[model samples]
Target: MASSVTILFLLLSIISMGGALASSKPSGSSDPLIGEVCSTQSHLVCTNYDDVQATSIAADQVATAASMRDASIQTINDLQEDFFLESSLVEGRKIAIHNNLNDPAPSRPFVPSSAVSSLPELTTYNALDIMSYFGVARDSSMATAIVTAAYLCGGAALPGEAKSCAASTKALAAFVASELGNNVSIYATKGAPTTYSTSTSHVKAPVTILKVAKGSVEEGRKIVVCHHLAFPSALYYCHAVTGTKVIQATLKTEGRLRAAYIKAMAVCHLNTELWLSRHPAFKALNIARGDEACHFLVENDLVFTRALQTSG
Candidate 1:
């Protein structure tokens, strides 16, 4: 079970960190998006027409920057939602979790048969639908929200906005790290450790996989018990421990099997800026923040890595 989860996390991390799944076309020269110079005059007060015009232009630039930031956020949310849906296959693959597994016959009961002579019908859901129904999308959604927010801050029009965004992103990153059971926070705003090495190393936290094993086939009926295990970065050594409140809730509801699978996925090479560009709501607002964010950070060569199933 631990192995299964490791595989799942590794796979998901790949997708989450994978290059932007959605891309928009390049901006035409007719409408320039970047390097649009604004007047830099520092007037004591807007006493004259030129001064007022310059100040107004600066205000527009700031407003434009804000709009773009919002767009990037929307894109990240979409990606996160998509990631969970894709990961469901590995999360809910167990025989016990599938009603069809119980009976060899293709037809099984999903909705009860109205007539005695009628056969009990079965319903087969695709990978995404099954995951959605079980609410396995929570983690992906959360991760996306954090990543997108960070990207937005970095792309803010003014340098001040960028620094603030970076700081904010770092904070959200800390929050996500906590949720993922990692004590280390990459974002410094939360008072998390500032470094990750020996001399500079501030903290190290375990990434864990929760496993449940049903009774052996030889046994009359399979009774599955799942516990949590922590592993180093590579996920090779999973050490068992007591379940957290979240884990316990999942177990009681028989949802842990899928929840764990989803939680265990890790993402790699995620481009913070690119994700912000593909957000849907941003399109509705007539703003192209996602594209701008990518432009700002692609040069820095940013990449994100984490655990999960490779196939998801």
Candidate 2:
């Protein structure tokens, strides 16, 4: 007979497999690339913008603009992959918890945030409007990502020489990740740490420690568990000490998971910003504080949280 943990993992795997299969199916109605690019109706404009940007890059005076455009496109694809992978793991965790606790599962299927429901007609977009779509703040990491993408995509002229968009985007992403106190190398390796370090070197403040009680050793432990489980390629177990209260223990575990989910999603948002900035269409527009974009990101995070809670 399979152990409970084995059964739990199997059930979770099936859910993940289903989502993957659904994503893999080819759509007959829409341009597949456009479908991949826009995850929601709100993001539809971004796809049109990307097309115009690509065309402009092809026609730019810089000799390397074409290559830069291709690189930018590839970066967007990479960001999409990162988003999907992170989302899958989070969804998988939700499934695992639900099954393990014998809770009712989510009624609806896991619809990806970026999944295209209908094909949108290509429309004209002003540079300002297109820039507004990204929802970037002038000094935010999103803004930096866009600038970096522009330089790489040959949308902006580099003073001395040109570099490949892929290389530039990668370097810029790493730099931004580091500046934001994220684990820069982790993005490339795409794996969770084997052992949780007591060191706070890479822990971003406010996100990791906010609302957590000071001098509460257990709270820190819970945060570490959440971080370990939520972001990485695999989940890690933290042993509960003997005789912990059942209700209290459950609440603690749930809190940790929630915190971890937020942190992981925030990272994905950061990555998305990097790719969003690089798209050719809005290269010339100035980035300002975008309340809508920021709200969308927060709303997406909340939706994920609610889905997990309701289903679990």
Q: Worst lDDT window (10 residues) for model 2?
A: 243-252
Whole-model lDDT values for every prediction? 0.20, 0.21
Looking at model 1, report the run of 10 residues with the lowest lDDT sum. Answer: 229-238
Please report the candidate that would top lDDT against the real structure: 2
Q: Could you give candidate 2's per-residue lDDT for residues 1-312 as a string of tens digits?
A: 732110001111001211121211233434332232222443212222221121111122233222322233343222221111222332223312111111011111111223222211111112212123333443343333333344324333222222222111122222222222222111001111212232212221221111111111221111100111111011111111111111000101132333222211122221123234444323322332221111001101111010111243
lDDT of 1 at 310: 33
Q: In model 2, where do residues sit more than 4 Å from their true spots?
A: 1-79, 85-266, 270-312
Task: Residues 1-312, candidate 1: write the lDDT tens digits.
Answer: 332111011211112112212111222322110111001121101112221110111122323223332243332233221121112223224312111111111111111112211211111112122223223342344223222333432333321111111111222223233333322111000001112232211122321222322111112211111111010000000111111001100011133332222112111112224334445434533444422111001101111222222374
Candidate 1 has what TM-score?
0.18
Clash list (residue pairs), candidate 2? 39-114, 146-277
